[model samples]
Target: MSKHVAYTQFIDFEEDVKIRARDQARVVALREKKGWLFRLMLGLVLIGPGVLVMIADNDAGGVITYAQTGAAYGIGFFIPALLLSGFIAYVVQEMTVRLGAVTHRGHAEMIWGRYGAFWGWFSLVDLVLANILTLITEFIGVTLGLGVFGVPHAVSAAAAIAVDVVVLLVLRYYAWERVSLWIALGNLVFIPLALMAHPHWSTVVAAFSTWRIQGGFTPAFLFIVLANFGTTIAPWMLFFQQSAVVDKGLTVHDIHHGRMDTAIGTVAMVAVAVALVILTGSLVHGMPGASNLDIQQILRVLGQRLGPIGEDLFALGLVEAGMIAAIALTASTSWAMGEAFQWPKSINMPARRAWRFYLPGLLSAVIAAAVVLIPHAPLGFLNLTVQVVASIFMPAAMLFLLLLLNDATIMGEYKNRKWQNIAAFSIVGLLVALNGVYGLSVVMPHLF
Candidate 1:
């Protein structure tokens, strides 16, 4: 491992953690015994993973999805709908915590070992390609957001890639993670921006209990729905979380806290997602000229209503969202490639130590940046393609994930309990059926 942070690289973090078991337990106890201190400490210690997960989910495409959702629905039902999406995200990601801890292996490695090369190749292909495309979108968000601040696209794109290279190549895991977390956590700027919109609280609340669609299911509704689903959870999330757990050297004892981290991320994601939908939906969706606008278009319209400040905040949130997702996606691609090919891959290692592990990510960031620069590319269709790929790969991803979690050898005594299995399978079934409906709605426009 490269010269990195003190905790994990120099020693077996899994074993060394045992030496500090006393302090670890004390920290947990301290968190429980106090209120404000617990909150503060929790924020300090548990901040990275949650912020990463949430912001990664809210990638550039996600912002566009939320933007479009707000323009069409006007905060009618999507606010509460996002609550369910967040819950789903938590339930799904929490499984990876136990899987990573119990097995001491990344998801790709586990799948390759147990299921053999066919499935391993399947998973890898999905992760690498999806990651590359997703990174491109992140660059797009950054460039577009910078456009709001009067930066040239080429300069912003080059600067963003350079910053990523420095973070990945120069910074050690601890510093890299901390910097990424701070940038990712800036996704919460949306909350204050939403609050500034001054939406009617009663109407927002009613959108939840009213059980009414703003104007019934339309093509725009379908677009936002799938986009929301894609943004909330995807193949990259699983790959990233599992690899993170492997890199972090979490053991069985930390599974509980790991799950807690996932849960915190879930709530924060929904809070921001809902706030965004409600902010735009209530403020601009039903305005005289607002009708089924996309995210970029929505930002411009929101500026018209709330002035430059609202638009600027939206742009800032968009950039943060993209970069946050890019960090996770790139990390995920590196880890999965490393594990699948049996290369040395760990954030704890320096770039020299794990050049093979880190190079894929760097190259991906470069290619993605280039992809964003292609003249008159059909970005709208490319976003649609991302969603389509997610739908296609989801069943296989969930199946492999379930197989690993249910395997007695891997999970040991911590295998999925009945309720966990129920939740997992239920999610799978629901997603399958939901996609089917979405498909039918696309083919037969009047049915939904």
Candidate 2:
């Protein structure tokens, strides 16, 4: 292999080399073992980037969006729609795994290397802005979720920052991945919380066949559809998972495992989303202005209907959603910046040695947390707006991703197959069409 390709495909840091070497050795040993349980153990070790990206995709903004969808429309449409979105997310993210594993470079780095600086910087700026907006909503989740336990916003925000910094700085890449996965397990809290709502099983099952939007083709319905799309398959996910695969030292050999990891995460992501919608739909649907109700109001209604325990579990889930996402977003920001600017970047590097790599992510999180503390800020709108912004930006991001994946010079044998390209373009087409429809709706309000 050429030096350029080799460098693109592997970490250069001594610390990263040592750690990943140890990990690779372990994988080899596991592969030599002869049993299904050993295969499962091997799979566990290989399952970080995909799972983290998907679960983190269900961030605080996502929690709010799902809750709002449930409250406004019930489980009639979005439950099945959530499953579809999960498939979309998996298809997109699986490509990233292949790209990262084949090239050993983050998405930003690949864009910069293959494309030009103009496009590269454009993609970078777009990602940074979207990540900042999305990160702020995450802090909104952290503060609001903890507010249920009587924790003040400032305190919750500060504590969240502390936890994020420690996790990013103190842990090496392997440790960070393990810890993040453990925290991500908290996302399942929404499942039991949904159960607390005691939704009718028949109604939930019937939604698959019904698949009807509650309010028909209204502007609000369109907005929610876009918001759900944004939350499910945002641009940051493409960057984060690919960078994570690189940082975690996945190679073309690990593509199968990486794909499996992404698939599992996709299922978890959709299941939790369905649960959130069900929880709110069973309790809050049909309330006055349900579509317009914010997170706090939604929580209050949940409290009223399911009692305080339901409220607390939902709140705890929100906090977990925010905290885990903050970790991923912070790391995503830091990794993208490092890749774009050629700064030294790797989670394996200790803070004392790689503060430049870590500072941007930390700073972004602090700024987002500060914004969440603004008294009477329209956080609910801000949260939904962030997801919409992501939806608007996704097509551009997807375009770049498609171009990279189709380039045989880079992807070689792993170049996107014909079916994959079709699926990707279809997703982009749907996003563009919806955006245009939304624009038409705004311009000529009487048409619908």
Candidate 3:
């Protein structure tokens, strides 16, 4: 068995090296070409990890959170909040692109390599726990969304897991990423759905000037704020993007393209997010118990206000959100595990040789999907709670990220500048304070 495994690794390694050589040769050739068309072609080639991560960031949990936000509070406050979150997402994720390109190392490997075993183990455990929890929410979104069309929960969960596994294991890295991106485009379904709602453009534009939560600083208000932050900027995103950049074989030369990719994705993410909020805010915001309704109830409201077709479109969007996120999350889990254990980590490697690398992610997805199949699960609360949990864990993740970005020995000239530090520090500071306030709201119940 040992000899067989070693032989498979050797074979996979040789094949992957050839694959990378061919891909990089094209990249070098493209770099030398000087024309608008060539530049556009180069941008398309170099744009994968950044855009995928950003799109996957708007996963099932994100869809639910944004929808809930609009249902509960209207579009007044969160429209601006989502915009701020997008800025924060770009600021934080852009750093990862540079870190990965400069160091050619995954976030897990760097944390372990530079910070000692204790910190490494801490980060790995945190990421795995958070990722599994997030995957459960993704599965919940999948099953619940499909439930709209009378699809059985069991079938949806099983089918989602099966598709997710096939996509992860069947393709090498490049094909896997391209397929995921195509699916991610389904996230924009919410835009047309929003337009179908015929929202008051004047009210939507006025949200920026009237930036205030509908219900003062209540516990519900606090939860939505933190949940929004959590969904927008999760811990898993950091590990996912950095590992993706490493696996994609992006280097310093591609950093400019990486930045462009991230920028494009950020715009798309914010656009979809705002669109969902608009759809729900227009249709469900004034309904009784809007703040507390589960996604099913929210869908019912949308159907009554918009119609069955609108409801179906929203459900389709939800399923796509789950599918895309599951793909990205499963890959991230596999990559982090492989990096930490010093296993062969690239998706370019044959799955037969890297089964150990693939198993953890697929296993997590199966478990999450199974949990969604269980009867009488409190999935709605669980979805928001997972996002809150991510928010709570985010400060620690950001701390590691900031430390890595500022390390002169590792990052050298790529080390974060003063403005980057200020922006990052502010994000971390806001997360910490929000977490503290949420804890107070739970404990004291009357602080606000």
Q: Rate the local accuracy (lDDT) of all candidates.
A: 0.78, 0.91, 0.90
Q: Candidate 2's residue-wise lDDT over 17-94, tens digit each?
A: 675686678778888999999999999999999999999999999999999999999999989888889989999999
The true-versus-predicted C-alpha distance at residue 84 of model 2, in Å, is 0.9
Clashing pairs in 1: 2-349, 2-350, 74-281
lDDT of 3 by residue, 235-300 (tens): 889999999998888899899999999999999999999999999999998888888887889888
Candidate 1 per-residue lDDT over residues 46-76, each given as its tens digit: 4455457766788888777777677777787
Alpha-carbon RMSD to native, per candidate = 5.2, 2.5, 3.5
Worst 10 residues of 1 by lDDT: 2-11
Clashes of 3: 0
Off by over 4 Å in 3: 1-19
The runs of at least 3 residues in candidate 1 whose Cα sits more than 4 Å from the true structure, single-residue gaps closed, are 1-43, 442-448
Error of 3 at 97 (Å): 0.2
